[model samples]
Target chain A: MDSVFVHKMWNDHELSKMINQDIPFLMLSDQDGSIGKMYGIYDEDSGVETRGRFIIDPDGNIQGFEVLTPPVGRNVSETIRQIKAFQLVRESQGTEATPSGWQPGKQTLKPGPDLVGNVWKVWKVSEAFND
Target chain B: MPEEFKPGCQRPPVKKIDPETAAGISNESVLKEAKPSMVKVGKPAPDFTAAAYGQGKFVNTSLSEYKGKWVLLCFYPGDFTFV
Candidate 1:
């Protein structure tokens, strides 16, 4: 897809009316798929990358990344949730790992203090946690 | 014509089909016929020195040079395709 064609589409009366403001965008090409392979997103069978997206911090640490299989679109809401969760953790004292199905404003158990007790309390029903 | 065809067609089937014997062979036994060499991860990746277009000229780049920063080496069947 050409940027010129996108710009032309955006300039149309119906499309222009939907946008209330301008957004900054960056476009980089992976001609030889060097970066794609580095991130482990390149698929050899299709000769194209799987639908993978990464949110890397300025310091080059991968804050979050998601690889969606073919025939599935990315979940924008989940990505935004991850970004917010990461930002919140960065702001707070960092001593916790988010459990499965974790959400904001939930009780985050600190790993160092009473890990066994916490695990028993959290997963009382699991057979692995029993003894 | 019938006598000529009968003489030409009369022969025992050399390849015999044994369903019971064939059924004895398990999936794992069949797969063990050939073994493939495995590459260990976390051990150093294979190094290759290739002529790369860098700094406005073609120069040789090796895996040993980029030891500190993570290096992503990719190989395509060929260039000019959307791989």
Candidate 2:
């Protein structure tokens, strides 16, 4: 996913070095775009696969899915945040909901039928934004 | 199995898909059958043969050659960039 694409295209020496990497990462050639087609990530008009990340649960169900456009690099930190949030939800029956930009130790709101409109007030903040 | 149609034999009905309204699978059962075809988490990737150019030679490599070891399959649109 790094500059390896250039090597694949230009038939450079780095292609062999990249294929020899030890890290558990995949490098597939999508020249024909068939794999992307099966994943529904291929854009025929744009001629590129959308940057996508899917966190599949141990049971194989798609627990979280994110697709980012090329201009925006993926937020690895935010992805970890989402993973922790989902893990918390799975472990507890707490009715709390993670708010925008909510990280560890950030204030979370207890969601309920009656508290739907006032969920944001749980945080000690100055900005008043609507969801 | 004839290469060309001959005699009075009737051909099977042709199931036509209108190009104007080409769509994905509709039957849940058929989709279920298709579901297993995708690369699932923790499962072996499907076998493929592709030309790998390295060391000034382009040789065909097969997925089976990488068996018993982790493989990473990455793709990019084209080459030559600041990336």
Q: Which portions of model 2 show Cα errors greater than 4 Å?
A: A1-21, A26-32, A124-131, B1-83
> What digit string (tens of lDDT, one per residue) describes model 1 on residues A1-131?
11223333433433335564331221233545544565566664445555556654333345555666544566666676566666666556577655545556655556776786667676434332212
> Over 4 Å off in model 1, which ranges?
A1-23, A120-131, B1-83
Q: What lDDT tens digits, residue by residue, belong to model 2 across residues B40-82?
A: 5434344566555444444567666765443334333344321
DockQ per candidate, 2 decimals: 0.02, 0.06
List the lowest-lDDT window of 10 residues for candidate 1 chain B.
Answer: B4-13
lDDT of 1: 0.46
TM-score of chain B of each: 0.49, 0.49
Cα displacement (angstroms), candidate 2, residue A42, comes to 0.4
lDDT, model 1, position A37: 61
Clashing residue pairs in candidate 1 (N, C-alpha, C atoms within 3 angstroms):
none
Looking at model 2 chain A, report the run of 10 residues with the lowest lDDT sum: A21-30
Angstrom error of the Cα, residue B22, model 1: value is 37
